[model samples]
Target: MGVDNNSISVSLEKLERFIAAALRRAGLPEADAATVAGLMAQADLQGSDGHGIIRLPQYIRRIRSGGINVRPDIRVVADMPGMAIVDGDNGMGHLVVSRATELAIDKARTQGAAWVGTRRSNHAGPASLYSAMPLRHDMVGIYFAVGNANHLPPWGGTDMLLSTNPISVGVPAGDEPPVVLDMATTVAAYGKVKAKAKRGEMMPEGWMIDREGRPLLDPTRSDEGFLMPIGGHKGYGLALIVGLLAGTLNGAAMGRDVVDFNKDHVTPTNTGQAMLVLNLAAFGPVGGFKEAVDRLVGDLRGSARMPGTDRIWIPGEQSHARRQRYRETGIPVSRGVAAELDQLARELEIPPLA
Candidate 1:
């Protein structure tokens, strides 16, 4: 697909290298910079525009402000046969969650299932990034995270006590793309609001509302309102449950204890996340499980659709297609985002992304 006129298309290789270079200049070790950069680029590759290179400037700011530890001693604080708790030491979220997910996958290989949780991590982009990791090993991956900033209120209240806590699940398939579902418990993630503000675009009416309960369509005025939960009170409930699992249960920050990462770049957020991996072989034959998943996926896609609907889509299919298309046509970065990245590169005295 062709990129819009207001955007620039760049190869994934260039994007990853630029991110890594900028991060390295900011203080992260070469290996850590490369690891975080690769995941950030993969977010863009999967069309997660809000969580990709758009976050580089913020991360750099935090790093420079000493809010993030460049050389964190990420280690498992508590360990059991089927579970573990990792302390990130205020490190970058990508690196923290990657270590936890790796531990989860390793344990699941022998234990049939494993749950790994992290504390003192930072924003880790989209949840699907980690959840999808287990798919390569023919294991189902489930991930949860407490958003770095609290943009959500409890049901029927104006207090920003909750966040756009997210959940992601990845199920491996035989012939079909993995069934990956990644979503915020809110109607929209705050990252999307940030993305819209950067692009100078208005948000849809339902994403948020002002303190007076009026619709908030202007992304630039996002702070004046709070994000709305999906499915009304039900989404609020889910967000709370997710926060308890990913945050409170792990002894990480939650509720009022959560730091506003966007405004308070100097304070550690103590962000929390959890990764659960289930070995398919333990449930049954891995191949059989995958085949059944493929069959169900085909059935869903071929099912009848509503009058105006052209086709039915399985979860993650669109992102899968985006990944394939991006490989061929390059990833699209809005000019606004590109300009900011260029400015950051100038400040870092590194090569520009273009």
Candidate 2:
């Protein structure tokens, strides 16, 4: 099965509208729902389709099942000049993180940098949005998170022990797209596996393997396997470190406690995560750093492409292009996603999207 390439890029505004409407019907206040919906839509614009509108149905399910709080009174449980810990009050991750990012940016403006962590934050879509906040003020932003669901086992264990645990870094560059690199520590994100499984497509080599060490590309049998780390043991190490910092350090769920939001929607995720914002002026002039970043991107693109390659693409180039195009055309929800969203709207008694 193949999708029409011409229909792939979705209009960003429409996507936000759909999500916002859905959340309101699910009982979230209009303003809070719109804020989260807008962020989710922007995730798709940035090429994080798995983290974007694809999560709408799950979010709805969580809210209806009393898992996620619709009117959470998010607040800071701990605070300092350069650091703080947030209590999401079982609210949506989008609201919790937006608050944390704002707090970080405000404090960074005064301290030249700041770090913020959040506990009890639910799934917040992609990490890039939060990481890109400081760019408006000429600051570099970095974010990491404990995946709401765990899909990987320890190097030698069969028990699902860890999350894909993504990391996103955004660095502003003069006259060039900010160098934003958002990637899962796993060779392939768990979403890719789900997509493949849904489409009845086999995954490419190295995406996963059975516990016995044989390649497992048949996504249909994914439950019997685990995701492969990016570079074998090295990637596994990084995932472990991220789990510690983003999960354990934040005093949130870890190890066997991570509830699979997809499988069960009634449990409080208690997801933990942390981010650091670095003011460019803290190191030097913002202009100089941006120029250096531009040069850095230029240098990478100037490198020779491999045989059969079209052009050298930077880490965030594809996402940047997607953002521009999707901002023009509404994001494509695919026939399957649309059907799911429609079903959710019915359950909530909300008017469905066209």
Candidate 3:
């Protein structure tokens, strides 16, 4: 049972099982493996292919090399009425952040809002995973993270000192799908560049720039250039602020302390992440608020399009459609990614994903 060389369409169940098995083989406990696998699979279902199971090989490598703790004693180190800090003990990021998000949601249910931070965690999947966690409870979720590696520099300076530093917010609606916004401060995320390189594709001109500030379109030459920020100094400022809140405030890796997890698998990245949960009932009636959101979303989507545009879409509209399509059909995996996963399966003596 192998897939074609061009691409592979994997069922959600198969993908989740394969990932869980791989994680178990990599020494993660069964429950922990299942938790991580489910979250990563949800990421893929939501169209975040770059942050889904594609990261398994790197995570497994880090685990095997002792970069991540397999048996982590994750615990809350500081506690307050509406805020708390957790130490992940260098555990898998998905596990750490999932726990943190749950804590935030529980606290917010009672206190109206709660903020939770995690330190000594690994690279979790997409930011949307954590941000969307509160949607089931009719709460708004905000998530931020210090990226696992530095790929950009200060607005004008040449030194690479800033990561993409992503953020996500998920707001529930009455009858519409939740509005989820997930974005990096940069023009493009470094993972997209890596995905392009894996597919042997050229990047868009604006994605990166060389030291001389020349457009660099070749993804293979990413090392020779730095990722460009979205709005020059503005994006740089956003990244800096996110890093401070998610990294410095949590006593986790940031700036010069961030280790390139893709390159170095042995060092503990101590990645920092934060989640804030806001209870809708805290401000007013949850039902009224959600209905208002639904109306707002409808208004946005009903707007007329420009000359070449087809239709207008809110933040999570396309992703919700993609998730539906993937659920009905299957998640498409590029040949390169499938091959890498196959190799990883073989190395771990687990069933291959096809």
Candidate 4:
């Protein structure tokens, strides 16, 4: 593998193999490592640049430092007909959430709807990864997570008590691509800020604010400020609700207890995440519902556009387009991320990603 025109284009197969090898070197079982690698590669394929292989080095560092459990016995601590609570046993979040989403889909198939929560999980990839899981089953999926680190505070306060607290929802459609909305409660995800810093790019003014509430545009000064909520008080409220539901409800770390996984590699994050599945068949014929969704999506996209606008887009439309382009052209890896991964491969005695 080699860089082409200063951009490293990686095939999904090669990316998965490289990630699995790194994880195996970090003590993860082969099966578990491969499972996670596939999910991370899928994230990258879907244009989730921040949550994909970009986080591999950090995950491997945590695993080597005993912060993550390689062979976790993820099990349901409490079970009901339509709901369940899982203990991830401090395993990789991709594994834990995958299991949880599967369980939710299974339960939803039988009970019309299902909700599953997990604790003791590490940082999972993008929220869309789990939220989109149920689309294949003709069911809608919703996912929420308390971010691994706190980057925002309550409105009118500077206490830094809230994480990005992302939420995502995926809805199946008939003719149109599935509609998926994935977003952080903040103006920007902390991972995006970190990525900008790594690339030596400046942050936008609205992304963060300093202690005195001045706009902070320098990515390197991220620690000197805190992320801004999307809509000031409203986004702060949403973040609070998400944290409470994903963290407090699941008996996992939240607020001040969140460990900055980017800074500390030795502490188990004990992250909390929740997923819900709704069976479309429960309401009506799946085909009819999907057709209705397609109609709605079409109506939205067909609306008149303002001046200088090309066209309208549904929530997941851009991601779907990006996925197709990336699949055809290969995923692009930034130079900085490529270098870091190369260094990691050398340390683990595995082949470099190139």
Candidate 5:
């Protein structure tokens, strides 16, 4: 590990090991701990610091409080030729969604397309992690999730009946990096606000607003405000549709029933998620499709820019660049997050992150 004034750079291997050790101490099985840790570390490697090891302490707290099932018997509760529903048994969301993604990829191989949904899961890492899973198999992946907490309300209402409700899509390219779009329907995800609070930073003006409809810039006072949607009423509509598909359709928690996992560590979140995979071979010649994608990406990148714009960026381009850069220089963790991890290490009686 390398330490600078404001942050620490730790190797991906060491970070994953530290996360796994903490989870194992929290009563997770060795294999499951390792699996979840890998995904969490990958989130940081891809520049999603909010969903990475920064969340390990919270996960450990939930496990110790008996809010999450460490030995959950995650299994398929409903099945069909092209679709399936999984019961997470209140397990960690990372493990549940990993299993669902694997199932979707397998089914898509034979069925051309497959949809898999999960209920009773817990908070996972970045949406892009699962959305990018099928890329290795030459498949397009789409994902949706009902957030663990409700932070938004209906378009002109103040009730807080909706969550961020994220969505992600991944498409493969021949020579260029894969296209992965992962984002919350809100202007910013709640995790970003929590991360800002952890860093003792203030949020931007448009991300949220107070009950009085004034801009809320203080992340520490996040509970007093609500997140703004992407396109006003339209984003709220998207969030509602996403919640219905990922939560209600799968018989999971949504709307008023969604628990605020941040405040209550003793309750099962019952988070819901869905994954859809489409095999490229099923559409047309895979090689031809990839070539076309490459050409399109090249055209987009080569397009003219405005006076101040540097260049056009494809979806997932920055994350792909970060993944490559982090592999060489290690992932960066802020000093605040490092201190929290250190505290967690002491509490768990485990070695601190190097």
Candidate 6:
């Protein structure tokens, strides 16, 4: 069902076209904006409602405010046979990082393995996109990102000083779907909660809580609370480790230096992210690795489930399935996000999604 101006239920094509038009109107190069627009659409296709077309307004704001460079010539800043650091030149995160991943895949093909890191990157839509790139070449890709904002705090501390950093991994198989694992360190991604809040819905208890350690289900009160990390101290540690690897190692922002892009768009974010591509040939036979991965994933999915689950499921199955469904149907956006996009389109004097 299509939603009114007060709501958002847009077809996949409409969302993509709207984003492309808006981005181009914002003065980004056509090809660059198109690339980013396609990835953002894919984020919606994969049921990443929080990371998909919802970000258009924020991206437009950044571009118009001079935070993102419309014509950035991304280049390698430091290099070796299997290691390199890329400079994003303040371009759209999606375009710059995807280019970096391509570089990583090319190097891995020749060097057996490769590690690529980036600085001056913006918040890319989703990490899985880059990590899934190498799989088409029979290689495994691992990705990590420094979240644009700090929402989670160090374990045992009340200060919100760390981001809910995310990691994604993809492995290719012969006949079965590739095993893709994409997740954030937080119990729930901040986007989901923001969406829930925008829709005036209550969040689950475990997603967030106030400083007094009480559950915060009311999205309106989210500001007074902070997101809880998954596995408590363990997720906190993972976020920290990823920050060190993706940020500090690349000479990008870390700790207090990270610019909260959502609040301030004029600052150079200096965000850091990294991707590692491993050619299967380096370890063993391609067929062997694929077979092993297939078996491993099959085993995991076959595990006995508790009463409520119905059946055990692997990480990426739900997302892939949802993508298929949404592609055939349409993306269901919340009322508030649609309004935000409309406002942005009006400001840019471009066509908006309907």
Query: 5 or 6, which is superior by TM-score?
Result: 5
The model with the greater lDDT, 5 or 6, is: 5
All candidates: TM-score? 0.99, 0.94, 0.98, 0.98, 0.99, 0.95
lDDT of 1 by residue, 8-113 (tens): 9999999999999999999999999999999999999999999999999999999999999999999999999999999999999999999999999999999999
Model 6 — which ten-residue stretch has the worst lDDT?
Answer: 1-10
Which has the higher TM-score value, candidate number 2 or candidate number 3?
Answer: 3
lDDT of 6: 0.87
Question: Worst 10-residue stretch by lDDT in candidate 5?
Answer: 1-10
Residue 57 displacement in candidate 2 (angstroms): 0.9
Query: What tens-digit string does per-residue lDDT give for candidate 4 at 1-354?
Result: 446654588988888999999999999899999999999999889888889999999998898889999999999999999999999999999999999999999999999999999999889999999999999999999999999988898899888899999999999999899999999999999988887876778998799999998999998888899999988899999999999999999999999999999899999999999999999989999999989999999899999999998999999888899889888888888888999999999999999998
| Candidate 5 per-residue lDDT over residues 19-76, each given as its tens digit | 9999999999999999999999999999999899989989988999999999999999
Off by over 4 Å in 6: 1-8
C-alpha positional error of residue 281 in candidate 1 after TM-score superposition, expressed in Å: 0.6
Candidate scoring better on TM-score of 4 and 5: 5
Instruction: Give the runs in model 1 whose Cα sits over 4 Å from its true position.
Output: 1-4
Residue pairs clashing, model 3:
none
Q: Which pairs of residues collide in candidate 5?
A: none
| TM-score, prediction 1 | 0.99
- Candidate 3 clashes: the total is 0
**Tens digits of per-residue lDDT for model 6, 221-314:** 8778888999999999999999999999999888888888878989879889999999999888999988887898788888877888887777
Give a tens-digit lDDT track for model 3, residues 1-354. Answer: 235556678888998999999999999999999999999998889888878888889899999999999999999999998999999999999999999999999999999999999999989988999999999998999999999889999999888899999999999998899999999999988888887887788998899999999999999899998999988899999999999999999999999999999899999999999999999999999999989999988988888779999888888888899899988788878889888999998999888886
Model 2, residue pairs in steric clash: 10-329, 10-330, 10-331, 11-329, 11-330, 11-331
